[model samples]
Target: MTIVFISDDAQALACGADAVAAAFEKAGCTVERVSSWGMFWLEPLVEIGGLGYGPVRVEDVEGILTRHAELVSASTPHPSSSATIEAWTLERQSPTVKQVQGDDLCVGSLEHHPFIARQQRHSFARAGKTRPLSLVDYTATGGWTGLDRARSMAPADVVAEVTASGLRGRGGAGFPAGIKWKTVLEAKGTTKYIVCNADEGDSATFADRMMMEGDPFHLLEGMAIAAHAVGAGEGYVYVRSEYPHAIAKLNAAIALAAEKLAPFRVEVRVGAGAYVCGEETSLLNSIEGKRAEVRAKPPLPALEGLFGCPTVVNNVLTLAAIPHIMAEGGASRYAELGMGRSKGTMPIQLAGNIKHGGLFETAFGITLNELIHDIGGGTASGRPVKAVQVGGPLGAYIHPDQFDLPFDYEAYSVADALIGHGGITVFDDSADMGAMARFAFEFCAAESCGKCTPCRIGSTRGVELIDRILGSGKTAPDSVEALPQMHNARKAGRSRDEEFQLLEDLCETMQFGSLCALGGFTPYPVRSALKHWPEDFGQAGSAQ
Candidate 1:
């Protein structure tokens, strides 16, 4: 039997997948490197005789190989009951094996596993099963059906179907995907463009990376659908430089799907490592080989973008979701699943100090507590769950007390937070909220494009103010003259009041005066940190 290994998972590679594969082959086994099951902790995971095992070392493989069948079903089970585990028992449930075709390990179906069991994986159903860029495997798994559906329909029908699906941009910006599509369709340019923002710069985000590697066809088909809907003949997937594996897969997949893509051509462009480049305008500028700066809005991309013409700029998740919407009769299939207007499934990426860190695709409205405690199994540190940072680096730091909030656009907005790109990073009780707030500004300062003063200057100043506040517990600073009076009524401290209040003022200026979200959203984590953990900001005995 062939031994299967994850070929593209970054963590798996880091964990010595190549060495394991080489050892397996040297020992006279047919080694097959495959896609990941979205379980980061389990790689370089190995599947031998239909059973999966991971975090296994190259040396560990020798003993397992020596005892092949005996070790298959006898390996100790991981504590996690998630489906991604290899030591599963068929005695528990019906088996749904997608790969590693053997009868030894006895693990039941891939779908029945705990991590994947509850997920509604409309877009990513075929990720781990199929080889990347295998056109035959992609087509066999229901891949180009959406583009075929779009091919038969009129452009207006495609737009209408997407509009009715209630699909919003899966990027940090929660704009309606159909509205943007409709705008592009109606724009007065005969030559329009489609840009898929694959520059995933957020911390703890890998949905785009995995999708690009495992299911590149799905993204290409989605782009083709968008091109057909808006009457565009050219497209681009702007992948970041960090993801060289994704870039290669996307380019190869594009080549494989060339015949199906037709007159609507799709190309992969690499982006420089600027967090701000994930912003649409900066992305457009980078694509055109210009300085990656944020452009002012109003003559929007739908009207003028990607070489000063009508263009559609969408994130990888938003575009990748298009294929499913088209294949499932357009709207009702996906629209009915989510909470409120946040339609469709979110490929939530769990990272940082989490025990069961991986991708979980669920509809909107799942509580933070459920996601962190149940799915994530709390902190990897096994300590108290202190905080969860939702969205990206620019998102708010949520406290355990606020775990009651649901994962929806409107719900997060009500809490002055957002579900940006659906990245949730867990932090244990040992985490310092004060430092997190400082880093948010420091990150913005380092990544800012310098197009606007509020972001470029305010971020640097914001860091200084935080440092001053955290450094001392004395009287108020001169810049924040009003703080002493306002704070005196509530446990009065002058220096504490001055620095925090100064930080607050600086955040306000950045929020309103900044051009793009780089500046506009830097305040979210800072403000939320201060609001949730007042004591952390150099104050003594502040209550939660």
Candidate 2:
């Protein structure tokens, strides 16, 4: 009997992977639903024997199986001869096996695929490999070892190992994970909490969702280890409502691992899809059944969080890395991978108008030039690459001229950019930087929790100013013509230039005056766009 592995990931499901799996099952193939390979473009990906075929449809399944059968007959030690699917997978990795590309479909081993081959996967090591809920598969591939090792050591030693790993929070803030863990562990509180911030509201970021759906047990193991280290008896995973699939998977994983994660009970809390809830304080507020708004920070969440007690709030990726850090000798190996300060691998999500878009996990020193042109395969439209947003919507718009910049936090900070959530949204040459700037402000206005004045008021004003500057304002063109007296008086006025200055001033106020990063970082995109493409703002191309 032929063995088939089909992705049951949400993306795959949306693209008709279920039907394809059903088709294989009907055809007498033993179908195993597994996690996505992260090669999203090839969603609904199906593995027959050891070769991969994707974007496969129910209609195409019969033809694909026939072709595979023909190939197996010609090749020695055929898939049918192999004892099991795992053995078949390992055998097909031989150099003698070659990828076959047809006009109808592309057949190949994912291991040698350019994108998969180039990546140095750590967090996503089991991405395409494991049956997500299968504890046997999890253990076979080195899961729960971190928790076992963590359980063996003193709680303080676990914190020390994480600190030594040099792992920073992947959740845009870039705070040291070990430091946060240490503070939570050392805080004077009998009852501590572990909160996983799964509210991934940023545009073009799905790594968190993917992790939760694909390898939930790993996340659970990590959280359980953190619970052991911090003496926390309870935990919560705060996920956004947009990801029902992830939430479902997590709840299922928690229920399944009840015995393994004794004493540290985790509950899944759903957010109302507020982007502000992605903030640590706001996430805590949401978890506490309060309005999801940013909280003032004198009492940091580590010291006073989650029902006014000590809490460890970590991002999905941050907590997921804990297991890796706790594994024997994993910290030293992980620390040795990246460039200065930024140690360990980063699961950079390549998104937007790019070819071969997916999760590319590698060390921190990879340049944008390499990522965009080499790894990403450039713009999907085949147009000239223009600006690439390195972070999220609030991240600065980096021009292609700066493509040589390394994927490091400090380097991005120096360049007035941020490695926010490791989301790189590529844009082609046709993109309007000024319009993009306006959208940034508009996004802030729509998402602000309304606790702060600058973000709430400044963003509304920013939209109006940008519209006038871009010649889209209501009275912009006809103000001089419609009113003769006003036109005469304002003839000597540098109205456009003044508007630019006012916009800059508003950005400055929002940057400093806002209570949180929601307002503080909104200016990053606006300023970067103005600096790189001044012509878009009705001025010559001069750096501001």
Candidate 3:
């Protein structure tokens, strides 16, 4: 009996994996629904005897099975009467698998695929290999070893191990994870909480959702280790309501792992789809059944959080890396992987207009040029890469000239950019920087929690001001003749120079005056576009 594996990941399902699976099942083939390999472009991917076939349709199933049957009959010394299938399996698992391309039916083994082969997966090592809810599969792959290791040691010893690992938060802020855990552990509280921020609202980021859906046990184990270190009895995963599939899988995994977790129980909390809830305070508030809004930070969540008790709020990826770190010598091994202050592997999601958009986990020193061109395979449109957004919507728009910049937290900060959540969104030459700049302000305006005036008012006013500047012929020249006539009498003839100044002033105000990152970081894209592509704003010399 030939076994077939198809992805049940949300992206795969959206691309019609369910139909493909049903087609295989109807043909009397042994079918198993597995997690996505994150090779989204070739979704509805099916694997047979270690060979990968993708973008498969219901119509293609018969042809695939027929090809396998032919391979089975032709090969010599076949265990299941399939010599060719055995050869392919050996090739996939072997050190040197034949790398072939341009064949729609077979891309060979995904292990040898350039996209999968090059990545140094740590937190996502078990991503595509196991059944998400299978305890047998999870343990066979060394799942609970980390938790067992953490449980044997003292709580402080567990904290020391994590601190030695040099792991940083993967959720935008590059704060050291061990330090946060230490604070929670040392904080004066009897009941502490571990909150996993899974409210992944970023446009190009899906690693969190993938982790929860693919390897839910990995996340649970990581959280349990954190619980042991911080002396917390309860944990909550605040996932956005938009990720129904991830939420469902997490809930199911929690049920299955109830005994494994013991006193350190886990719960799944759903967000109301508010983008601001991605922030720590907002997420904590949402878990408490309060309105999802950012609370001013003085008493950080590590000391005062979750019903006025001490708490450790780490994102999905941050917690997910814990299991690996807790294994023997895993901390030192993880600490040695990356460059400079940034340590361990980052599960960077390559998205937007890219040829191979998926999760690529590697050390932090890889350059944007290597990621975009060498790894990402350049633009999906096959056009010259114009700009790439290294973070989420709030991240700065990086120009082609800056492609050589290393993908490190401190390096990006010095460059006036950030590797926020490791979500890279690419854009081609056809992208309009002016329109993109306007969209940034518009995004801020629409998603603002409205608790602070700078973000709420500044973003709305930014949209109107950019509209006026765009209409004032700023893209061509600053001359009065080039400017369009205003419809309002109050401001009949405002110069483009004045509007530009107003925009600059507004950006400055938002950057400094805003309470949270929503108001503060909105100026990143706006200013980066204005600085790098001043001609887009029609003011070539106006970038400051």
Candidate closest to the true structure, highest TM-score: 2
lDDT of 3: 0.87
Candidate ordering by lDDT (highest first) = 3, 2, 1
Tens-digit lDDT track for model 1 on 129-217?
Answer: 66676676677778899999998999999999999999999998889999999999999978999999999999989999999988889
1-544: candidate 3 lDDT, tens digit per residue? 6678788889999999999999999998777677888998889899776567878999999998876555434442222324233343454565423433325587766777788889999999876666788787788778999999999999999999999999999999989999999999999979999999999998999999999999999999999999999999999999999999999999999999999999999999999879999999988998999987889998899999999899999999999999999999999999999999999999999999999889999988999999999989999999999999988999999999998998899999999998989999999999989999999999999999999999999999899888887784324333554446733224245677778888899999999999898899999999999999888877768556
Query: Which of candidates 1 and 3 is the stronger one according to lDDT?
Result: 3
- The runs of at least 3 residues in candidate 3 whose Cα sits more than 4 Å from the true structure, single-residue gaps closed, are 69-102, 472-493
Model-by-model lDDT, in order?
A: 0.82, 0.87, 0.87
Worst 10 residues of 1 by lDDT: 85-94
Q: Tens digit of lDDT per residue, candidate 2, span 105-143?
A: 655767677788888888888887778888878877888
Q: TM per model?
A: 0.89, 0.94, 0.93
RMSD of model 1 against the true structure: 6.0
Rank the models by TM-score, top first.
2, 3, 1
Model 2 RMSD in angstroms: 3.3
Positional deviation of 259 in candidate 2, in angstroms? Answer: 0.5
